[model samples]
Target chain A: MSETAQRRGRGRRPAGEVREGVLRAAADLLLSEGIKAVTFDRVASAAGSSKMTLYKWWPSAGALAAEAYFAHSEHQLEFPDTGDIRADLTAQLRSFVRLLTHEGERTREGTGSVLAGLIGVAQTDPELSAAFSEHYSAPRRALAVAAFEKARDRGQLRAGIDLGILVDQLWGACYNRLLIPDAPLTEDYAVALVNNALDGAAAR
Target chain B: MSETAQRRGRGRRPAGEVREGVLRAAADLLLSEGIKAVTFDRVASAAGSSKMTLYKWWPSAGALAAEAYFAHSEHQLEFPDTGDIRADLTAQLRSFVRLLTHEGERTREGTGSVLAGLIGVAQTDPELSAAFSEHYSAPRRALAVAAFEKARDRGQLRAGIDLGILVDQLWGACYNRLLIPDAPLTEDYAVALVNNALDGAAAR
Candidate 1:
């Protein structure tokens, strides 16, 4: 029998339940006390699980933190798809900005800080960096890419436009403002960004 | 007498020399050993200065690190003022990308890692964040903004373009790629990014 099955046969909690509890504990520690506090010992104790379980599942603190962070933020990546490309994109970007700036109601407070913490740790942790890109960044990027491609196919985007670069322009601006915190990510800023890219910034 | 004169009268090295030495040591530690090794004591000893001197001038490790990092990178921010906006902007961005990716001859290897380390720490260190934005980000952003404004006055940019947003798009795209590391930042990417921004992405 698998370790999970053996644990279940021994009348301990199911493997999935234990994983969920551990993740929840990790998330709670991350959100409440920052990334530094979410150590294996603390998480295991908080989740009522063994350190062996966490180690078996996640190889490092960063890996565990990445998974917890992803679970906390997975729902924020839902991009809207209205028929009008401009309006659709504007709304999508506005929502993204709201989330990044912690202005959205659905997102928990301090999400940005938690994310920034993960980003910092991920810089040195190769496994965490790859996991963050795969689980957190790729899906959201795909949503925007899909939207741009759809607009292109429907004859909305100008001919010869590189959709990848276009998406980069749109999202990159938001991420810049978000990361720097020098400027506010207001709704107007979002609208202006989308319009600027769509309607070229050059003088006629 | 000023503080520098008093310190000199007391047989201590001049304030300027002390500050420079400390910064040099901090930069050396940051570049050679990474952020973790740049503690105040380490920097002071490395510079042959005292911890009291480092503490007197910079309030925190992050602040000292920011100043040191900025000093090392200040020359890299000199954007050109060639009349051709596209070419000028492309050259500037290409150089910026090369530095961020640690591909430039002038930029040391592992520069990206140092930068990423600073960014990670800055997320939680408000003093470092402020100092970085003030000493590092603001000046470079101002350079880009000035270029765009000059281009607009010369009829290079299309009318009704928001210069702030345009600059953000240009720099932000590079930053996003830098932070994510999912995409390679090539010279062609720089050229294409500038071209896309200058020319509208909409179907003409």
Candidate 2:
């Protein structure tokens, strides 16, 4: 599984387009089939590429699925910065919840399963874990941290707060629900999580 | 994989002791050898029980592993109620973090890897997921929620706060760190999570 693949076959389309096509195919397989369904042969065949391209491009099926997942739902999960941390946080989390749970779409469900699949496999797959951090979790986390930093500078958040914990309490909780699933990952839960994190649970 | 086995063997110690021995063997296998190593044959051989006994009792390897994990760590993870919510939570969470990271043990890294392995496999293993919520997470959560309810009753916590979210923010954060590994799951982080959660992150 550690064999490195290089560009070999003559390409009719550009490498960028080929890569995007492969990712789209991979994401579709992941969403429709499941995490275990995404294999190099399947993705390569579905994307009209060779196994060499896939091996050369992605380290593992988990890594490819992570990048595919990110490519599929990037714009839908972006954070907003309106100088109001609470409102911005709520909006982003709401959108995120909607995407994860398929809150409003006609489709049966959304990327929640896909994301959960990647995360589950990432536990044992080092390449997938690194790619999950590099492609999905790290960048998403940085966006939220940036918002927290901005809010802190604007006097909305408390000074010298641990922004990393904020991410864990908020997004990590959502991930927990996705995996554990004893509780629903809903818009209301997302909103409450933000409110609860900002306003302490203890009595004032 | 779903064969049922009844108590067929002749005189052994007792069903109770036999079951406990099996659980201990399974837990030891999990901690030492990782999740993939806990196959039915291996556990049966390790515990000196027949594979028929295992298949009859547990739904899957995942289920058996879940039970084993819970049996091993149950006493260590008990939540305390000393009438002081902050101190109690800090103490319990510190113990939990220690066990997970082997923070205070000469025994290499503790149950953190085991628990993370369980969670990761649970994502795909339905039997594991159900048993996870049933024997492990559900009971564990009930203990914490009961503590929260008592505190809420005593005017220590805000009235009508979502105890589930509290679990998510605190323990869920720990689980998130274990899975994601972006941050170290240290006792200090646990303390900060509990404090940040209780006191809220907003500036007054």
Candidate 3:
């Protein structure tokens, strides 16, 4: 009957829907522009919402960025289980490299521009840090752990070789490559990673 | 004395000396405050100099931080050539872990914090990334490579083992720990790295 009702009838959305829209906008910003460009104002404008709506959902920009980063990457780690350990590992490691290097180029851009800015902010903000650890690091870690466990179950891995260490080695290799851009994460290098870590190799 | 001489007496000293002072201050800031806090303004103030002086020495904060990080860790790696590969590797890996994890509680703090921050920055900055490769990553890689080389020479390592992957596995093990704060970089684990990489114990 009132203007609010009239606006609602004219395609206005509820507050919950507005929050999802804002989050989606933030994810788009992270993928396209990076974390630095995903501000509350920008997200609000892009989602046809207001700053108050964003503030109501996220306490800080870092929190919002963390959520956005997670949203962008949530569907990323669907590791397929092939019958062969070697084949599956090779494919998975290759995929990991691409995700960090080629496929996830935008996240890399955001790392320096927006993610770094958010991380700087996160260092002082415990809530954001916790959120980052939970959303970003945990999921990836779980995926790697699952991969290693599967490998072990297939009798492709050694009994004493720690799954935790193996997971770290796989992810750490990619992290190192991304962190150091000049060092190419080539196909040869990816092959070597699986051979040395998964299959095992001579020390020298 | 001329006005220039008067100014020199108060502020201007040998440019080299001033530059060294600024670098030293930058190192202290990097160690104390983490990488995000190492700004030209902070470095200049800490060094008791002007921003212009700091800028003249290092073009950017990343440059300054890289130089400072290397300066602090300038000790050339001592690769023990003991005939026993196992003993030699154990000693070397122990020292590596010590350097990486042993300063104080702050030792882990410094290495992990600075490395994570620098790697993130180096993702986009070509110059810094190169410098990081040359000064930081190269030396560590060289040490790992050399250790493998020594093993190969002694016939302790398998002939077909890939040095590139070998290096990644070793470093990746350490790095994985750094990224995952819950796990400890233990000496036994370090030994396991050498053993597993050298003679794979995969379930097969």
Indicate which candidate wins on TM-score: 1
Whose lDDT is higher: candidate 2's or candidate 3's?
2
Question: Fnat of candidate 2, please?
Answer: 0.74
Model 2 chain B, poorest ten-residue lDDT window? B1-10
Go through the candidates in order and give each one's C-alpha lDDT.
Answer: 0.79, 0.85, 0.68
Best first by DockQ, ranked:
2, 1, 3
Candidate 1 ranges with C-alpha deviation above 4 Å: A1-11, A103-110, B1-11, B103-110
Point out where model 3 deviates above 4 Å: A1-12, A73-75, A103-129, B1-10, B73-76, B103-110, B124-127, B180-184
| Model 2 residue pairs with clashes | A200-B200, B5-B56
lDDT of 1 by residue, B137-203 (tens): 8787777888888888898987676788877788888777777776666777888898888877887
- TM-score evaluated only on chain B, model 3: 0.83
Q: Write the per-residue lDDT of candidate 1 for residues A1-204, one digit (tens) a residue.
A: 999899778869978889998888887788777778889999999998999989999988778988987786544677777778999989888776666666333346635667777777776678778888988877777777788888888999976766778767988788777677766667899999988898878776
Rank order (by TM-score, best first):
1, 2, 3
Worst 10 residues of 3 chain B by lDDT: B101-110
- Candidate 3 scores a C-alpha RMSD against the true structure in Å of 3.9
Question: Largest lDDT belongs to which candidate?
Answer: 2
lDDT computed for candidate 1: 0.79
Better of 1 and 2 by DockQ: 2
